[model samples]
Target: MVRKAVLPVAGWGTRFLPATKAMPKEMFPIIDKPVIQFIVEECLEAGIENIIFVTGRHKRPIEHHFDINTDLEKHLEHAGKTEILRNIFHISRIINPIYIRQKEQLGLGHAVLVAEPVVGNEPFVVALGDVIVKDEKNVVERMIEVYQRFGKSVIAVFEVSPKEVSQYGIVSCRHIERDIYILDDLVEKPHPDEAPSNLAIVGRYLFTPTIFEKLKVTPPGKGGELQLTDAMRLVLEEEAIYAIKIKAKVYDTGTPLGYIRTLVEFALQREDLKEPLLDFLKDLLSRDIPQIHRT
Candidate 1:
């Protein structure tokens, strides 16, 4: 069983620029909660008991979010905000959180490698901090289901347009059955024509402890960073790696556009803000004069 999860939060959010200079991208608000919170919630929902966060120097807030704020708790109790107190206490109970720093700005593959000491010889899930999966069922839960049935490593897959395949890790799946597929191979950022399949590997991953050994052999790729995808490709030769189509609308908040979109989408789902948010969007669209009009 995948009882532990590793989240790599050490990446520099250069895409977000000045805003990220002072704040971590994982802490960016998605409607009401931060992005990392969503990822943590996913792990908790999937029965993960331990969360290993491979964080960097500036990621104290991420750790703080998981720690119990005794002063705030006392205040909440004094103020008699029972509901708010319960909510705060609930986050503290989710998992046994552990944090480790990845000293170098290595790639995703290296980030996962840093957690090897803690992960030991158990299967664990690696969840990217900035990706939120809002689905009919929990994305982690879906991957866990595949892991249980196949007794092997699994990667969450989603169908992306051919044009967008180059921006993601594309996979070739032999067959599909109710959101699960048997992965033949994975090609990271392949050209559209060369792409084996349109199914792209999403952020969620279930891997056996052996991946650390494979990652050691995996060479650095584009930008001299050790990509997790490269490591998985090597492991595929010896182990069964499956892909499950996640039943969720994934939002990549690592980039500005995706970050803004998540805010809009999540805001639209909020009961109190939906009406106002809709009206605001309608007003903005109605007032925009630069849009090319069709006769």
Candidate 2:
């Protein structure tokens, strides 16, 4: 059983700039809860117990988020906010949190490699810190089912546009059965004309410990970083790797635009905010706004 999950949040977040200078991008909120919190909740919901974080120097907030904040808990209890206090207690108690600081920001593949000691020889899930899937269907659970059936590592992929192929790692695979693919190759950020297929690798991955050995030999590729796609391609050589086409809407919260869009979509999903937010959006869109120049 896949009982552990690795979250890689060591990126510098240059995409979010000054705000990220003081904060990790994963700490950004979807609503009241931060993005990392949502990711942890998702993992826990999927039966993941040992929540491991491949973090950096700037990611202490993540550690603190899962850890106990006694004073805050006491204050909330004193204020008679039992519901909020229970939520805090749940966050601290439910997760088996382990944090390993990556000495330097190498790459996603390197981050997962450093987690080898904690992961041991078992299979684990690698869920990207920035991507959130509002999956009512429990996507991780589905991936686990696929793993049990095929006895091969699973990669979550979704179809992307031809123009967007350059932004992702495209996979070449043969359709095995409904939603399953036997991967043949992985090309990281290929040109539109050069892309093998539109099936882009999404944030979620399930892998055997064999990936660590492959990652060891996986040299730095684009941006002079150890590309996970390069290592995954090596895995394809040894055995068949499977892909599950995710049917849920995947949210990428790594950039400013993606972050804001995720925020709006999540807000729309809430019961209290749905009607008011929809009305606010409708009212805002119905008018012609005057452009204001920056001072």
Candidate 3:
């Protein structure tokens, strides 16, 4: 069983600037719940026992969110807000997260590397805090199953358009079975024509402890940061790595535009907002959208 899971959320969200200046991007709400909470809940549902969070400065809110607040709990109890109290109490009490501070905003591979002291030799899951799948358990649970079957690290991949390959880490692989592949090579942000295949590695991964050794020796590549793709390719040199194509909509809330779209889409999925939101969209589209020009 995969007992531990790691989440890295230390990057400075420059793309979501002014708002993220104070608040962590992962704390942004999808309807009523925060994005990171959704991912943590998904991990817990997949039977993940200990969740290790690789965080940085200005991320205290993330820690406090999962910490107990006896005053608030007592107030809620007295106010008779039973349902709301149960929900929050579950988060602070049940999902006890272990936090490790990454003093530097190095890179994704570096962030995962910093959690090695807690992870030890066990195979663990690394989930990017900003990425959210509609049903992440569908991916995490399946990754756990594949890890057990192959005893190799498993990465979640999904088909991206050839033109969109440069935005993600592209993988070269050999077909093994339904929605599974034996990764042959990995390239970080390759151009469309140079991409090996349309399959792009997303933000979720199940990695063996050996990956830490690979990451340690991985030299900084694109953007002068240790890319996880670069380290995974090193892992491929020693042991086979598997890729599973997840069939779910991946919401990348890394940029302002993506965040706005996710907010709207998530709202549209709610019963209270579905019909009303559709009407609002229809009415807005019927009017003229004036384009603003720089003076």
TM-score per candidate, chains pooled: 0.95, 0.95, 0.95
Clashes by residue pair, model 2: none
Q: Where does candidate 1 have its weakest 10-residue lDDT segment?
A: 286-295
lDDT of 3: 0.89
TM-score of 3: 0.95
* Tens-digit per-residue lDDT, 151-262, candidate 1: 8998898888889999889998887676678878889899999999888877999998879999999888889999888888888889889888865688888889999999
Where does candidate 3 clash, by residue pair?
A: none
Mark the 10 consecutive residues where model 2 has the least summed lDDT.
Answer: 286-295
Model 1 stretches with alpha carbons more than 4 Å out = 288-295
- Residue 8's lDDT in candidate 2: 93
List of clashing residue pairs for candidate 1: none
Error of 2 at 228 (Å): 0.4
